[model samples]
Target: GRPLTFPPGYNAAQAFIDRHLDEGRGDRAAILSRHGTVSYAELAARVSRCAHALTGRGVRPGDRLLMVVQDRPAFFYLFWGAIKAGIVPVPVNTMLRSRDYAVLIEDSGCGALAYSAEFAGEIEPALAERRPALVLRLDPAEEAALFEHGPDRFDPVPAGAERDCFWLYSSGSTGRPKGAVHLQRDMAVTSELYGVRTLGATAEDRFFSAARLFFAYGLGNAMTFPLWVGGTAVLLDERPTPASTFATIARFRPTLFFGVPTLYASQLEALDQDRPDLSSLRACVSAGEALPGDLLHRWRERTGLEILDGIGSTEALHIFISNRPGRTRGGSSGTLVPGYRARILDDTGAELPPGQPGRLWIQGESIASRYWRNPERTAAAMVGGWLDTGDTYLRDEDGHFYYCGRSDDMLKVGGIWCSPFEIESALIEHPAVREAAVIGRADGDGLIKPEAWLVLTESAVGDDALEQDLRLHCKARLAPYKFPRRFHFVADLPKTATGKIQRFRLRLGAEPAG
Candidate 1:
């Protein structure tokens, strides 16, 4: 066994630019957006100027710098600038309401707030009352002027293994958001896992993912992974709708495409009518939810790319178990990446044998040190060196792991435990079903009964027989206790922006029992 370690006194991100900032790579595109392209030379200049501006405003090492910006060149510059100055950039979801913003701002204890002009209207009024001094705005003209007047380069700060690199806010479904803190050393672990083992990003590769930089998966895959391998990343400024995302792929011709299963479903829905040129896509990766086998098959058939399904959490920073490009198993999440280990264990901490579903526990160097300011919660989730992933999985005899529904999504039907994913995956196997979500509803007998919510494809519309046909499809594929007892047809399934089906919302909408 090999012990993972970071380079001695490493600030690799800044070191990368220190080695390349002067090199003439004007023709190499670092970032491409709908508005325009940003070459590596331009990006480095802006980052240096931004670093000087932040330093002038008293920003220093260990200070948390909060930023709210859409995916653009400015966002990238500010992020790298903060890292260069040894300040941690905490990027929040720009779509959050004022109250949500207030919670994150107060919780993170950010010293400065940075914003883009477009988001100023919504954020300015919210922060007007408690105005922080370092209110840096992302104006391209201002950045250009600053670069012209300021020195071309600044000495990059030296950061050791324990130095704080960045903070990622986890979506706290039950309570306030918790910041999953990461140290500088976590970079080496992440690069080895996602970069070398899973994605194998190289300087010649172009990586594109639907997740934004704020989200952990997106932040690592799009920003760190690409830069670690000296590759380019395509950032989508606007929301990644099915049509817009396809258009970007067609134009950019990204070598690697990353998204969730819901995004894949959307792409499949729109693919039949409008076939975008996805010929350049070399590999596809799906996360945030279980990638149903049927959806994987459909996407592969349409795009001619195999989707490598993965499972990860914010606590672990990113994916540890991901299907390798050439050795993808249609229904498995693949084997654990090097430098990480996963186990399926019961509540009592006993390991489960193959084919038995249990809570998945992951131990890795990339795991977050702890939840910020929440010692009790951190203690509850992290035991010894392993982090309880809260996800359920079953490993087959072949060592490939299959994702079951979340531990909370399990329901008891006639005293038999059932996973909603089993029902949903079976429903999706039907040709008429576009998407499906299965949740438990209390029935007349006072026992939880499984219900299916479905969005039908055009081929299945206006045919009353389609619903029964889908039911039969599930009946043939799954056990009787796991079949959906009720069906509700809808235009779309309720999902988070990251493409996770909101099972909690479904549980809220069920009819009250007598």
Candidate 2:
């Protein structure tokens, strides 16, 4: 985790893709998908062809190209192709609607859009609204024809480390998704610090992450981390259900598995019905949200594989604080990853003492320098080279950081600050509850009170008696004031594309039925 040194004019494509071939690993498998396995040589050739195809359609260095492809080998080709040709690739969530796509197209002012044919319904309307100069649709016939005509060996543009390489749109849990600009060196920094040092990834390992490549977590897990070490990545284009995930693991026998907490919960539930062979997995990672201690213990007991939960952000590019492979603490976010400096600061910008919860600020080379087209937000978030993470955390005496809720998510109840995470954790301990989300609901007097939304297990009945039992259960575990005043039985909680519970939507009076 020492600071990585890159020579002048570093292109991320060289480190992520071409380095494998340079090291005589051309015959090794680079990507595994439902279609088939692709070797390093084949992948590199396809990337070259993709770059050629883009350039043939008038793409140039520094041009912004928006990508809306699913999780497949094609995504890798398009992403690395843009980087190779010095075009800044902007990967977006494929689940977004036409309106969201329209906003992104306008915000990025992209010269071209590359999308798979499956997403034509969503992309066509956006394309009609904001007509970009070029659109590359990746239907099987069209894509194959383009690659067939394009050259298989083209020299990559020498984009300096400081040049923009890609942009990841925020999950928009709090507000509209903002484009976070990242440079060529940012990918290498995270791959070294978190992937190499923290996860202990190697060339022999096969990685499979349920998170898609568009999001920051999935991009690092399936793309950069494995590719950096000349390892193989398993890509799944379908929705990540427990059945599908376990089937992929059985088929691919991946050495590493990456998932969000919600997926882990569902997988555990699936294990109750049918336990798939998970012996191939050496480690499983959790992010996109905090992992509950109860769920972690259950997973370890069931699968015998430790879940390494970490905290990362879109702006930071990848995980800055994470639990290492053998040195994991069950509930905490482990220690700060190497190559990053973190500080828990008060509202006045003064550092807080250990064990005192405060705003978490981090400074690292991988952190994005700015938000695209939002100078005010960029200035507010990036203060003196440190990125304000907007999360509240406390460091214990053992140097491990514990997650409090987001600063905005924290509730002031009867002159006391309370974290919804604490209440949600306590609620999940109940046998009937499978998942829980707590949000502050305003009462008639305008005083904000804690309200709970519960997703019950299949055997649990949703009735007045069950509600009372859960209320009393919280009363036993949490402070009386901190306990949720109202409990709402829900079929499912609203979530962002990344699997984070959309508490803001719940707070906006999107009430769930009891």
Candidate 3:
């Protein structure tokens, strides 16, 4: 474990933006996007200019900048520039609808808003409800002129290690999103522990992520991980389908590729006909949702590269427990990261043994300081320097952590605790099943039983014969009472923006989108 230490006047921009140029990496590529390659020297100049642009627009220190921009070099420039000027930048998902934007606009109460023209239809309607003091569209010509008159020799803000630098809203897996306030030193902590120490990132490595920059996982994977070691960040601005991601990898030839479990499963399904040259990649990383053991083996068999599945959250900033390169287990989340502490606690808040399943709690320096303007939730979630991860987990005898499910997502069937993920993982192993989600539903006798919603493979049809085979498949792999009593062959499952299944929607009998 590395000690969290920083010198006086520890500004995040000085570390992530300006350090490369001071260390003789001025001409190196810092970002690669559709716009073009942005060198460290150019990035530094643009960031300084952006700071001047913000001040000229009446933005002051400690004010919030709400960014709904795309995954271009503009995103990097705006994010770093805000911190350099001592303003907080909050980036949210770009795939949301108009109503979503409206809620976020009211919740953020930011001084300025930056967005892309592609989402004008959604953002335009939201502005009628609430508008910030300043709004700018991220057009190339407009951005070029916005900071053209600013000086190039602007200095970084004098923010200390404990001062707030930025904010990231939660992905809203269960309810509304909460703004997580992060200090200036949090990103450096995760970059050192997970990126450099565990994954061996270096200046020569190129990084690409299928996840967008709004997520905590992606913020680390695409931005902090690469900039911490002066690596090049390869970015994509288009919607990430299997074809688009494969083309990006082939063109960029990145060393590390970050994706979620759903995207990996989809890519593996397309590999039979659309396999590309993946020789340049060292390995892939999976986070958002728990990675099934079957998907891991399938991906490795097809690509000859292992997928290091791990667990991270919006509160923890980045992965604190991950499966290392060659030390991966089939169905485990692997060991604790070097600078993190974990405990499994029962309902009474007492510690449980390694084999007993209970609530997961984590302690790390990179964890969020608190939620913005929500003291009640801050008190409930972050207490005594520990964060309740809101997940159910257990540690094995060999010191490996296993993910059960979200705390509320665990099922109680026949008066016994059961993890829906265990049943869903078993079902995903069947050849005809593409994806599966299990939830507790009442039966004819008013007793709880697992109900499986499945998305079948293209070659398979939902019929009585397939149903019988699925029954036998589950009965062989899971406990007798754990077998799903009802099956619904759905076109898709309800998932959050981060690709996590929304079991609560299924429990309410909401129709799955086609």
Candidate 4:
């Protein structure tokens, strides 16, 4: 791919919000939501007004504005609007405790806060704790009269390519989250590398990601990618369940769908009883976790569409290594995208040979320069301009990368390294199993062994007979020691907000969510 460039005075929002109008796509539908279809023209107008609203309230350039909003038209207006105004907007997960919101408020030291009324139970208490200088409740009047009444046009403040534009909190797949500060050029760089070159998105494409826009992967999938290509993006405010998602796809008729592995498994189970029209989709994408090979095969057998699964990080902004549109390999995070370089390295920092598992390191223009205010973590992760992904991977002879478990999540049994994903994927291959997670557990001898936790099918029973069957199932598919010594029938596996399995949570007395 050719190098991406911008004019002398470029704002990141120009590519996403303002570019469509410049390219003669103003009347095109930019957003499809439950509220209504929003054209690029209408979206741009709202964004400009939103920028004015912020400025009128004394929110200035370089000031952090904490956004605790949901997935809606308002999200687009405020997010891009703030960037256009030269204010850094920090959007966080809506489903969180009050303490979490409070932490983010204090962490960002934001001068302004915009929160949805729907989450007032959580947001209000957080505000009561540490209020910002400007607070806006996202009521009907707040959305329209406040932001909508302002001037419909504002000059986009020039944000050079090197200027910090936004901050995305890490998904906390391991434990603690870090704020990844992204520069202005990252938005366009990733949209070009992965969205256009890898997935082949264009104006004709309609995108619907089950993942919401607050997270890094979702930001690219639902917000930046579609906006960059001038494509129609479908937004859902409600949580992404099997029923809602299927119904949405049927009604909206999106050409490209994005989701995580767990949701795909659940949707496949629902397909066993309900057949919804998925003909509108040409390609489905999976991220946040490695989609099991067996699950990918099952979906292809049921629906003709293939899932282009890949790996990405909040630090990198979006997918740097991905399965190409027509060249997907189920278990592999396919070849690197055009602008990125990947390395599999040993514990000592030497590059590992092909087929050897090691920590993965990546280099790309979209990679975040550093974590906000944390010099220790910044130095550790951003080593010599390379981002240590903290994920263990092995590259096969075909230049395909296979995901092993996270570095700290790998288990050693009988002196041989075992990947939790390897056992989990094998367990998911069973007819009764819908999802599976494996973690190291200690026996009476104090030696670590594999323990399996499973979320079974609706009709399946988790009795002794089923346990014996699963034990035999694993014995036949995996190594003798690799088969789980103890099977724990669970309602669901604990997952992060983005749907990646929380193996660390499993190690802490595995309990299902209510």
lDDT of every model, 2 decimals: 0.80, 0.89, 0.90, 0.89
| lDDT tens digits by residue: candidate 2, 322-435 | 998877787788899978999999989899999899999999999887899999989999988899998999999878999989888999898788889989988998989899
lDDT of 3 at 404: 94
Q: So what's the TM-score on candidate 2?
A: 0.97
Model 3 C-alpha lDDT versus the unseen true structure: 0.90
**Better model by lDDT, 1 or 2?**
2
User: In angstroms, what RMSD does candidate 3 have relative to the true structure?
Assistant: 2.1
Question: For residues 258-348, could you state the per-residue lDDT of candidate 3 as single tens digits?
Answer: 9999999889989979869899899999998899999999998999999999899888999999999987887889899988999999999
Instruction: Note the clash tally of each candidate.
Output: 0, 0, 0, 0
Q: What is residue 45's positional error in candidate 2, in angstroms?
A: 0.7
Cand. 3 TM to true fold = 0.97
Q: In model 3, how large is the Cα lDDT of residue 95?
A: 88
Q: Any runs in candidate 2 off by more than 4 Å, and if so which? A: 1-3, 443-446, 510-514
Q: Write the per-residue lDDT of candidate 1 for residues 247-366, one digit (tens) a residue.
A: 999999899888988788878888878978888888988888889888888888887789999887887888899888888888788888877888899889899999999999999888
At residue 172, what lDDT does model 1 achieve?
Answer: 57
TM-score of every prediction relative to native: 0.94, 0.97, 0.97, 0.97
Worst 10 residues of 1 by lDDT: 1-10
